[model samples]
Target: MAGHHSIDYTSITAPYKELCMKGKGLGHLKNARGLSIEPVTGMIYVVEGGNTRIQVFSPEGSHQFILHPKFAKWGRVDLWGICINDGIVYVSDYQGGRIFLYTLDGDIITVFAKGFTTNKKMIIKMQQPMGIAINQKGDIYVCEFGANCILILENDSNNHIQTFHYQSPLSIVLRKDGSFIGSKGNLIYGKKTSAIESNQMIYEGIWATLCWFGDFDSNGNIFMSDMKGHQILIYETSSGRPTLLHIIKMTFVGSPMGIAVDRNGRIICVTDSKLHFFKGNTKAISMYS
Candidate 1:
């Protein structure tokens, strides 16, 4: 098995696919935050915070359509963290503290998850939720930023299964074996059980204001976007301890927020105003493959 020390970072190159301002009627992006790629359809989704809509693009980076959710008509919408599981698209509302489930065509199936009060006081709610992930059982795991914990919502029910405390977790990714990784402050942490010893702190000294979001590659490596640092931190996951593989410098992008690795292993990251794409060299391909 390939490990971090065995891989060569010098050969890895990230040539971006420009998803910038293309003018009116051409899908110009303003304050783009969240990103999710559909592997089956080869389509890309971008959440435009300023426009308050989701934009769909072709595999070749051409603008295709726009998703103006029904909630947009209700008032101001602060959207973040988007994930496509099965056929449903799950999006988090940063301000409303709710997760909305929608069909690929933008039809609202329902409000999947939202802030629930642990007590009758309703004073301490799961507010300011950010990144999200769905487990194999269809359970939802959300990064409740305000509450500083990951809140778990059981499949098809409003019941709370569990909650794991952290220091301002911003992103989350669940593995096939039920293990998960989350970014908090400048560090990435892993949790497989309730015990303290089972938790491993992956990366430290991130040198960023916050770790915005993260995703896993086809080979199980994790990629996190360091918003304030303007870079993507790649980590090799092994035995719950993550070793740094490479630091993808994003000097070309400003305020990087969301990062995603497609089925083809292409890295897609979204900044406040642009989207950047990264691909590895042929020799480096063997590592992920």
Candidate 2:
């Protein structure tokens, strides 16, 4: 858990394992950023900054299709974080300052929430909204990088239910309970004291953009990607102490961003260019235990 750990690539198995090869013609994936995997279908969705489109892949890594809004007019729609819940997919646009909702088939449904700025009076203005996650109850939590805070949006009402202000909250995840976990400015904060008090520092000295994606394992531990550190760090849910689990070094990948754990507890990571998956077995167990 302290230093670099290598993974056995030969033992990996998935539907699209062979498609992961370099220069495999993943269309419109230039500068790909955020990614999330569908639990039920095992399909992979990728976001590219330059293309401003969402690419869908089959569970086996075959190209299913590409998702882009027809006649889209939003300028600078750089997708940062994405999540799939029920049959809907949520994507956060950093430059568009809004969260876009789409069907599982990649059709733009609507804007789930819009970014806002508030002073003493609580006026709403659009800002750079990054990382997004949806809980079981369909509540969407969005992290605004420009505003340096997190906002919880009610699913049906479109009203801002709650706001957690911090120093550059890059990503957030809502747990099964009412509480949640988030990474802000190299520190991992959670609702330790109930009533949303941030008393936890999971790990420090991480890059400001360290935690781009995070997910909780079956054991209730949290795994997050450290973009600057170039590795995925696991933290005990109760204590928040980090144990280095896996270090991913591949061609054309410098910063690791979005991460998701499938139903089988396998870890799927998305970097600037590639999508990597690791079997969740002894390798993950040795790091956590």
Candidate 3:
């Protein structure tokens, strides 16, 4: 596959579709942040900070419904990150320092990991639960950016089972084997330990200001959204230095935020107000078609 390096991918520009509200009295996205795709249903779940709610869309890019967290019933505001696993959807309470679980139909299951507790007493406080990813085991890994670490929670109980310390980790991605890739400042590093000292430095100088979100595709390509760079940086997971594969230039949404790869190998990204989709020329993406 590497031999076909003559492919000029610069022509791969513009998103296949741009999603926004279109009907009478139908609100548009303002300060929209995180996004995820449900593989089985092909539904896109997006979290809007400005609207303080989640909007679900069909595979064809039509507005389907809105997901308001149960906390919204009590006046919670500003939803940040989002991810869907199985039939369950998880979202981050960007400003509240908490996480909430919900059904695909928007039924609030429970809220948890507000902070750490020992013997039923709140002892450790999590400053923020920003970017999140779930493994096949139903364990959710969250980046506590304000605290410079990541925490693991059981999907069923929402209990904080493990924690890994890094230097101002913003986004996190989990490997099936239990290792993690995190964005700290302008660099991306791999950690097999929860301790900051044992980090295996992978890539540096990834973003100019902030590297917010990332996800790995089936071909081991790591696509990360660089809000400051206004581009999605693709990295090869097999290389020792993780070679740069391609960059999906974000012309429409300059400040790209959350990102996810759909089951069909399409890249889905969102900005402060727009949702964009793209298909790349990566070897894995090529085989995926």
For TM-score, the strongest prediction is 1
Q: Is candidate 1 or candidate 2 better by TM-score?
A: 1
lDDT of 3 by residue, 13-42 (tens): 778787774222233677778888887988
Better of 2 and 3 by lDDT: 3
* Rank list by TM-score: 1, 3, 2
Top candidate by lDDT = 1
The list of candidate 3 runs beyond 4 A from truth reads 1-11, 21-27, 117-122, 193-209, 281-289
lDDT of each: 0.75, 0.67, 0.73
lDDT of 2 by residue, 208-284 (tens): 33667788766566768778777676655445444443444433445667777666666777666566666633442
Candidate 3 all-Cα RMSD: 4.4
- Please provide TM-scores, in order, for all candidate models, with all chains considered together: 0.85, 0.79, 0.83
Ranking of all candidate structures by their lDDT, best first:
1, 3, 2
RMSD, one per candidate, in order:
4.1, 6.0, 4.4
List clash counts for every candidate, in order. Answer: 0, 4, 0
Deviation (Å) of 248 in candidate 2: 5.6
Worst 10 residues of 3 by lDDT: 2-11
